[model samples]
Target: MHQWRTWHRPLVLFAAAMAVMTVVSGVGLLVDDRVLTGAAIWSKPFKFAVSFVVYALALAWMLTLVTRGRRTGWWAGTVVALSSFAEMAIITAQVVRGKRSHFNHATPFDESLFNAMAVTVVVLWAGTLLIAILLLRARIADRASAWAIRSGVSLALVGAGFGFLMTQPTKEQRAAGNLDTADVIGAHAVGVPDGGPSMPLTGWSTTGGDLRIPHFVGMHALQLLPLFLLAVTALAPRFVRLRDPRVRLRLVQVASGAYAAVTALVTWQALRGRPLIHPDGATLTAAALTLAATAAGTYGALRTGSGAHTSPSAEKELVS
Candidate 1:
């Protein structure tokens, strides 16, 4: 029982949950046969729920260490956990409100609940990623870790940024000229539609999907990019002579550029009032850019064979 308190326990649990989420999400994708929405028919909710649980448990254990004055990984993990919970809350609300359906629109319930929650999640997510970046910088002496940190941070910002702004309502005036006070009163009591569509569901373009879909795409960029970065870093060169000092820096730059391109494309889609499922020229362009960056990163990593070495630094010591 005493041994369970060690970092390995929670780390293993977190890793297991993540693995389950990947498998579950993949299966859900295969079954659903639809583009993955933030609040999708399957996968997204379960994944978020699992992530929330994992983060909660990990956070509790990490915070325990913090309270006991153990500082090393506590702060970073705590920040990430808080961010995860906030994101889970937002995703849960979207799921509950049926925000992923064909009549996809946020209700009053969703707006009131998730508007503030979404912003909070984005800020916390950024802060936590920043903390991770700084930690990597302090602890890593080699170029590989630096690239990982840069790639991770860049992707997180792009993803979280899209998520934060995606919920804002379109700039349209409220519906007017509707009457039937009795129906309104009765339907309000019975949860029936008194009008043509609910307020949140009303203004959404029927032809085009929601503009917020890009934000969803952007937010997960971090998820995929970091995995690649980690893999590349893990496969380091055997010979010291193969090491490239600039490899990490280049990888980070390519990742940043890729996400920046994504952000721009998402913003363009939002402005055009396009749904997420529609693959237009701009979306294709962004996809191409991301692929190009990925290719560049893969080539650079193979060519340089750079790897990172972690050690206690002035930053770590200060926290300790």
Candidate 2:
């Protein structure tokens, strides 16, 4: 119980609650056949609930880094939790009403809800940005862990910027004069019209580009980068002989750079109205270059560590 309390902070507890809600909402999805905006109404709640799990966990993990201003961490976590819950509540309510949660200003009530959601998201983004800055400024003892935390939050900020981009009117919508007719004028789909044919469960557009793809990928960097470093730290001792902490840090840095590059490439592809699976020659070339660079960096790290002796303390730290 003490260990659980040590690991599960307020943000983590909030995440656990969201996870339970996500499971319940997922069950609701199984029963509801009713479709809204070309997808099940229950899908919104399920997705948001699941996303909250990620957000809360990331926030909790970040808060652990701040040695000072623990109170500030708690306050930031509380604000984020409340804002996220409000956003989820509004989305769930819209789903219950059988209406779209985002970009649906058709009715006065919906418009108000939409505005409220917008405000909540902005507040959430601001709070997240503050936390990211705090983490970046903190002096962590572990170099690899520090790198991971810094890169994750920085990349997450880039992802949050994409959310604002998603709120702008798409080219198609602007061309069709949807801005005049619709109360809220924005879309997730880039090249194709919104609510078109989508992938099975994710609802990502199958026929055209989707901005949400990059947004989702980018936002999750907060979770992905740190988890990746942890996994590398755990597996490196058993699988490989290279045990230098600096090498491990360099590898993670390379991986973070690769992730950011890929996120940018996907966002560029979507903005150009190109689907992810159907990448053009230029996109393919860019991807190949990014992979090659990452591979080269990893190879260099390994080569540099080939003859270097691992310190007992460093090895212990890596294993821990």
Candidate 3:
């Protein structure tokens, strides 16, 4: 296991910054009684702060896993850190002013701020792409971890791209008036307006499909895929099926594909304006197919890579 100090320094500091923001936002949520968009004014900042904390930490840890891309990865990580900070700063500042952070139509100043936030997204995407490219060229010895890192990075990029869907003018927005001068250009929910009945803390829409569902699911693949590998490796001794490196690699690949499938399905559901919990028959059928495919893949991995036919000594040497 890597030590805390060994992780990417800038990203670690960025994570720490987000942690402080989290605390401040939490305090704001408790003390400030103001509401925006039918939710607490501080709610958006608080959620963003917590999310960036996890994101920065995961990215920092990821940077530590490979040795080859240290220089380029460090620079990319710095960009990511800066972008994260700028985004949080904008969100927090808007909260302090008792206003909506995203898709604010209040004044020209707020629109400028939102434009700056959009710039950060572009910078963040570029930095993430650089890091992903570098990671593919990294020299990782463990096949399972290597596959996990590569697939995770690729999927995370896809997830980030899905977020751009929110930037488009909503159907209601277009229907209302001229899109060229629309006050609110972007929204989180697909079918309904921004601030409706939402889930308790996360503010995910219950009345309409939330784009954030796919966005969240996709972005976290960077952490989730690697963690899945960690889980499989940890359970190797207890589970004979997981002991084989080939099996572990196969499982990670299957998981990566399955995760991508899930992200796609949710994005599809959101595009059709279907709430996640209230899936129509098509959504259910797609989900069922995904589940079936994943199960079949898992079984195939176990059957082919169980190490049952190979001698113990040879198998150990081959893996090492």
Candidate 4:
């Protein structure tokens, strides 16, 4: 069992840095009165800092779990660490300068910084993909944990890619024809302007659709799915059916499907310029169907585990 001491060094250090930034930014939120794009000026730094903490720490521990390709995984982890730090630095710098970080091209300098951020994002994606490959080829001991890790990485990639959708110029931006003049280009909000009323804290669009919603949901699947698997494992003692490895794996598959559906659903909703808080009939119906399907799938998986493959003693030891 590899401990934190043996986890990826660069990633752990990066996570530690981000943890400090998280505390600093959180304090800034309480003291600073500056606002950016209808949110507190410190908001971007705080959110990004916290995200890096979760991502870097999780990635560090996960790479330690791999039995194969440790060297390649180390390189991948380093790439992710460096790129993550670059992206966070840019955001924090922009925040301090009273400027927007993403989708901003008001000045030639800002455009250059944004371009750099784009490069970092591409590198981050590639690095994550390589890590996924390592995880896929690893000789994992637990089937449930393996499935969770693999499926989580797959969904995370899909989620992170959706961020690119926001970079395309909106119809209004095209019609306004201010792109050449170095006006702001691209936006997170679909129907409304970027700086309109937003949800508290997260700064998510309230008046119109926001692409960030889906992007966020997708990216955190890497963490959420694994946590879900852990919860199931923890409850195995109470729920006899969950004691089986096969049942847990099947549930992970089902959850992965459901998670992907949510990502796609929110994406479709946003692209259609509909606010998440105000879902129409189509979205509601689709959500209902997804929930029903997941319920049925869970029932089926539980039924299969009725005839346990191993004795109770073996099952208890396996879970423990």
Highest-lDDT candidate: 4
Instruction: Select the stronger candidate by TM-score from 2 and 4.
Output: 4
Stretches > 4 Å off in candidate 1 = 1-44, 50-73, 86-112, 119-123, 126-133, 173-213, 233-252, 275-277, 282-320
Using all chains and alpha carbons, the TM-scores for the candidates as numbered come to: 0.53, 0.93, 0.94, 0.95
How many angstroms is residue 8 displaced in model 3 relative to the true structure, after the best TM-score fit?
A: 0.7
Q: Is candidate 2 or candidate 4 better by lDDT?
A: 4
Q: What local distance difference test score does each model get?
A: 0.47, 0.82, 0.86, 0.88
Put down candidate 2 lDDT per residue, 213-301, tens digits, no spaces: 88888889999999998888788778564357767888888889999999999998888888877889989999999999999988887
Clashing pairs in 3: none
The digit string of per-residue lDDT tens for model 1 on 180-238 reads 21111111101112122212312233334344444445555544554555554555466
Ordered by lDDT, highest first, the candidates read 4, 3, 2, 1
Shift of residue 40 alpha carbon in model 4, Å? 0.9
Evaluated at residue 22, the lDDT of candidate 2 is 92
What digit string (tens of lDDT, one per residue) describes model 4 on residues 1-320? Answer: 24779999999999999999999999989999998888899998999898889888878988988788899999999999999999999998998899999988888899999999999999999999999999998877777898898888888888889888888899899988777884578899999999898888788888889999988898888899999999999999998778787789889888988898889999999988888888999999999999999899888878877864667677555545
Question: Against the correct fold, how does model 1 do in TM-score?
Answer: 0.53
Give candidate 1's total backbone clashes. 3
Q: What is the lDDT of residue 61 in candidate 3?
A: 83
